[model samples]
Target: MKNDVFLKKFRQTIARYDLLEIPPAAGLGRGDKILVAVSGGPDSVALLYALLEIKDEFNLRLYVAHLNHKLRGRESDQDQKFVKNLASKLNLKFFSKSIDVKKEARKKKLSLEEAARLVRYRYLENLADRIKAQKIAMGHHADDQAETFLMRLLRGAGGSGLSGIPPKRGKIVRPLIEIKKEEIEKFLKQKGLSYRTDSSNLLPNYFRNKIRLLLLPQIKKNFNPKIVDVLNRASNIISLQQQYVEKNCEEILRLVCKSKRKNKIVLDLKRFIHYDISLKREMIRLCVKELVGDRFASLTTSSTELSFDSIERTLSLIQKEKSGRKVKLIGNTWAEVSGENLAIYSRKEKQYNYPISFPGKKNLRSLGMNIKSKIVSRPSLPQKIKSKGEEVAFLDWEKLKGQFRLRSRRPKDKFKPLGMQGTKSIADFLIDMKVPRYERDEVMLLTTKGKIAWILGHRIGDEFKVTDKTKKVLRIELIQKQK
Candidate 1:
């Protein structure tokens, strides 16, 4: 009777988790090498134990990586030791580290949570690369997922927020996602296993801990009794459907973002106005993620997901001004609308329009034309390239690099004009030439070894002005249809 009852409970838990292993073709498979990150907490410990139980069935090679954030001093070390002992007893390969997470947080000038998470993921990614592991398993469960969904919803999130934590992501998988906190505790009790409890979880200061301890419990008691289960079910359904939405989003994105080299994306407002709200939001989020790097920064809280910092803003800017307009985005990134397409570009890409390192032979493709160079006789350059008169330049022999850099002019740029005696600031020179407001900003400078040698389509720098001493000069030319 007891055996039957245990089996029934186990089966129910598996059903809830969606962890019923199918054939190796569908499921994670037996003996799949998985790296489990354990924190010695109840959830992670439970996951470790469960994986151990199924180790033989799965033909699994398991590795345990435990991080000691060292926030709690002795207690943190104790947790690390516990995980080490547990891994040792189970004969699992264990890697442990006591990281000075607080110190790193201070060094990076980031919040404690942000720094620790970044450091942890970086370490895990590095380990994954070294081990060539397909999956890195974490112990986030249903309760945590439910709380995350609720928190993101409160924080002005759309359906993407509702999607919550995934069971499997690239090289990262959460196998215990279907298990709830209560169910996990019950399983540990049934197995006569004890797990370390982090006192921080009881504290109401951390937003997540507070949700787990106070908000969710209150919701369960007064609002929804099976809230966790309902959320898990909703998340599962959402996850499956989101995959379809993601595929649609990818297709829409390909049409929307036309050029990778130009770093721009556009939602044909006419076409964008058609999709249903869910798919529309997903498309917007995915495009922003690809162009901008994170899904969190995709859109605003609205169903349209049209954030002020997104393609919507780029479109607005272009509508107001058909000329060059810049939108400074998150970090070192910016976006602008050029012609019909909304272009997303980082500040670095825009500011460093000049080549950073012109190493070796390069086929120049900027300046609305293509120009190729080879070490040959001075006569190799056609008369059109040689005597384009003021438009052509002969660079100094000593300054030429097999490899050089090119970039846009900076405020600090000052050079002595070839015929002039004094150093002239580029700022003054552009004013002297009466370079138009719009065109002036678009002017690019060719740089070699950190100094501007020439401004493309305009004038060569004073130092690079061909001198009598400069006999071996790099011939500059413009490819033209010869008359």
Candidate 2:
């Protein structure tokens, strides 16, 4: 009867989270392959058998994977061997790798546990990508979730962290997340299945182990006997609350946002400061996430590294009256306060310089765009005299002379903007236009004979503006090339 309940709950957990269901994005589909992360422990062993029971129903092609941290000498090798044998016995494909967790920990300046987790997930993701697997399944169970909640709670984590281990994130799924460790061990016992144990788990050296070994049992005996269920329930509540908050944060982001690029995100300082303090922090977190999304291997890992102290430090830096100050953020990113904008970016942008030819499209490699220039007769052009959009500009062709070159803004650059009688410093002009300081470096200028003709994607010089006397019109178009 208990064995039946275990299997029933296992399937229910998967269904509840849509673990095996087809996702909206290019993810799991019917009869798709899944990479199962099996460490040969009781939790993993039970997970493998549970998934096997539903293999035909889901049409899943299961592949077992194991990562040996090599922290336990012969024991690590034995764990790998056991997983390989288990996969062979089940007639499933197996993948395994060995890494020095201690060495990696020292090199990456992370704890042994953190290093092991990072390296293991990277290996699993790479293997899944190589084999074209649609999903990667982990063996994290309810007990692990409860422990994670306690750990993060102790560290003063917010709602995002308090949500605990997610059932599914991207291609990584934890079908066993709703199952408990004791239930897993009992399930394996009922099936007469044997599994390997990592001896390090018995030692109370690691904080997680200490929490699992020392703290949980006492709380269960002296306090709530169903602490795991309590924590799990709390995590679900927090996750739901966080989802709502994220939607509001996204809406607020659009309002305060100045600009966003691949590696940089700029927010309007004037607008950002007016919002409630909590909203400001959430907006900063969103900016960090946008900039660091591609930098980290997984979303959960990035969330864990986004510490409260780091967020507080960023808030402190941006709130100060001083500009040009920067603070380091997680995932190799940084936050800076530059004039009227707060910039969160990874690295400095490079300068761009390229030649433009008439009646031809020149691809600006650094700008990731193509600038097409052509001469059209006034009769052939639209009746409108001024530019319709920043991307498309029209100038008096006869007034311009010599070849045009597009380059990054220079320190001494000045331009007489259209409708302005006198020339103004490009730097002051951009500042008056409310362009972020960091983004000013990326602004390009189209110059002819050492004079600014137009600021690409922004403005056209007064001298280049088309007039009624202009017979020929120079049409310049900026086209963004697909990545």
Candidate 3:
């Protein structure tokens, strides 16, 4: 029968992808639950019917989940009622919820499309967790994948984005990913099943809708007649290649990066620079993802989804800039060069400023270091008075005027070095010291009433140096905090 042909192809796809058994190794067995997301559309309705036809063969438990995004008023409500009635007719359990997508969009400062998607997925994830479902199935056919690929391509997305929607992501599975939308409609019509159509989908307000209603049809008519098929095939090939590269990236990430602290990941500059540019881009992307995992998931355009420009800016900081340099990233994240390590971390709200306390320990929270200052007699000082390490500074206590403050370098700042004859601009001093331009702003200055007395981690001011005439000595030591 014509009906039999459609069922046969559906079964073949399910078997090929091993969708019945989530892990494939965990063979389709008894008591297995699958949450089917029914959006009251042709694609989803067809998916539900196909699964129902073969549910007994796999001994599967099927449940329908729907979200009423209150965008179309009465039409949206009707969609929910339709899906509920359909589920009841099949004697299956149905779960549904209503949400004001417009309000959510305004509150989150996101577009209507993005807000709806975020709220929809969050609801499904929670429902799946509550029911302990093994998999959440969605109806995203090959046409959707092609549309997504083209959309991302137009936006200048890289290989990962070009791969289109994945077949499986965590517990979410798309059994219809390889099927065409036309085939789904044909199957629904053959089965005499009626479904609700969302009027919003016909609107050209959204980029995806425009692609689906206008761009795709034009491409098929004017360009390749089988544009969807060609795009889907390309996506499949790119998906496999992306998986391979991502696996290698994970291995390289383990070898080159370490979890330095909460909200921070450090990559070894030495190893990172050796990698090819393609690998470097992926590595940076992975780092950003790791740094902001799940935090921006509700946002439609995730900050983790770095654009080509953002990745290039980050790579410039890593490859070209010197140690102590940093660049800001999306999602309130940033990448910094700390010595031979590159740190990717979330931004902190705390300002990096603290006054130095004499004869006591003052914790510099921003720098993750402690300033220990002690006023002691000259004899008590170390005989060597080793000025080799910048962390330790021996200054004449009497020479210091007013209060000492630790702050970042300011514009046109001038400081007289301990050995230099005259005062030199901080900019010139950093250049002379071979400090990277990007890192110059981060250089800390120990100031006495706004006069630079010491360039922390670098040189000390000549005016503040302890001479033979000095009776009292100020021993300032910079101690790194223990992890």
Candidate 4:
């Protein structure tokens, strides 16, 4: 008789969750490739061996991907070599990359741990795309989930944040999510497998490390010995409740949301104010997430730090019928009440006046854009050129006086909008355009001789509009800065 109880348990877990089976809604099949992230640690080593035991049963192809965050000098290299040898022993194809995580941290203005995580995931996604992998496998386990829950709890997280790390998200799957770290170590020891350990993990330099090395053990020693299990159970219960709430919230959002765009979301106040206060708060959180994109979802370590204060402030603005009232939010986002609609949008940074070099490009640092100006003869212009967007504007070269200045709207600024009878205040123009009051200050204005020529992304001044009598045209293009 075979003695493989651990392997049997692993298989049971996989089957219980249908980890290997392709969901009916998914576009791929069961035989597609899966990418496994191996960090040469005990948890990942156990995960790799367990998956290898069942690879043939599922008819799945396995590829190992490792990222060496070059923070440990020689030790990091040894870890990479260890993982490579392990992959070779298993006869699995391996892909590896090394990145200077400290340098990345400085460049991105993030902590070393955050930079490493971001770089590691980006590399995994790119490799998966290159190899046509259906899913990416991670080694996070129950102990990690417990630690995450405590961290979020200490930070006063709501239901969604208290749910802990998700076992499955998009194309990423955690095969060992329900397994304990001790169980992983037991499996590795039983199989006589060798793995490398990162010394930095022993240090309390990062918040998660502090929780793992200090707080968790103290909690277990002073309180329940099975605190990890208790936390994991609570996470499961909360996750189920959150899922139900989120489903209902999505339906309510669909009914009340007026519009959803790349960086902005609008919801009807009439329909939104009728929901219960609890659902109202959830609705505001979801709208903020939609406006700022999913990346902002993880802006805080707890992953739900979109503080109650911000949401309450926004709700108050909506209740007061203050059309132009707004409240700033985390992750450079804001919520404003505008004419029976709640608008959530990203805030643009303030910009100062900068003189534009004729026939040259000038960087708009605050807006993440560049202005390119060029003068060309009227005869050289395309005859049937369609407007690309409001970002690009053409003006009569002769109508311009001295060098143009790019700046924000002044208090007494006035502009002659194209096809308009007379000049109008910039404030009134923005109000008519429905631009949120808080964002109006960041709108770029191209002025020449103290006269408004173009409202960057909206309209061109009537005096600068190109006409048949124009001898030459000055073309100005606003190009977004690529990351």
Per model, how many backbone clashes are there? Answer: 9, 0, 0, 0
Candidate 3 to truth, TM: 0.70
RMSD of each: 6.9, 6.4, 8.1, 7.2
Q: Candidate 4 local accuracy as lDDT?
A: 0.81
| lDDT of candidate 4 at residue 154, scale 0 to 100 | 80
- Candidate 1 lDDT, 1-483, residue by residue in tens: 323443354445545545434336423555467788989998888778777766665566789998888888889889999999998998888987767989997886666666667677767767877887656778888888898777766665555557778765566777767667787887778787777888877789876777788888899999999999988788767767777778878887666654453233445544644566555556545654565443333222233233434545654575575445656544334565444444554333356553443223344444334444433344443433343124555665566765466666777887765556788888777777765333455556767766667766667767775455554556564342211
**Clash number for candidate 1:** 9
State the C-alpha lDDT per candidate.
Answer: 0.64, 0.83, 0.81, 0.81
Give residue 227's lDDT in candidate 2 (0 to 100). Answer: 99
Ranking by TM-score: 4, 2, 1, 3
Give the number of the best model, judged by lDDT.
2
Candidate 1, residue 75: lDDT: 90
Q: Candidate 1 or 2, higher lDDT? A: 2
What would the per-residue lDDT of candidate 3 be over residues 1-483, giving only the tens digit for each residue? Answer: 777877887777777776766333334447459999999999889989989887777778999999999999999999999999999999999999999999998987778877888888889989999999988889989999998898889888888788788777767778888888888888888889999898988999889999999999999999899999999999989989998999999999888985554456778888888999999989987777766665433332533356788778777877676666667766677777866778777765444455776888887665767788889998876665669328888888898969878887767789788888988998998888977544455578888977888888788998888877888988888876533
Residues 1-483 of candidate 2 have per-residue lDDT tens digits of 759989899889888998885434443456758999999989888888988988877778899999999999998899999999999999999999988999998987777777888888889989999999989989999999999999889878898889888898878889889888988888988889999988999999988898899999999999999999999999999999988988999999999988777667878988988988888888878777776663243434433477778878877877675686777777567788887788887664466677767867787765767888888998987677657328998988887889878888889999898877799999998888876566676688988988898888788998878877889988999886543
**Which of the two, 1 or 4, has more lDDT?**
4
- List model 4 lDDT by residue over 126-238, tens digit each: 89989989888899899999989988888777887888887776667787888888878888887788899889989998889999999999989999889999999999999
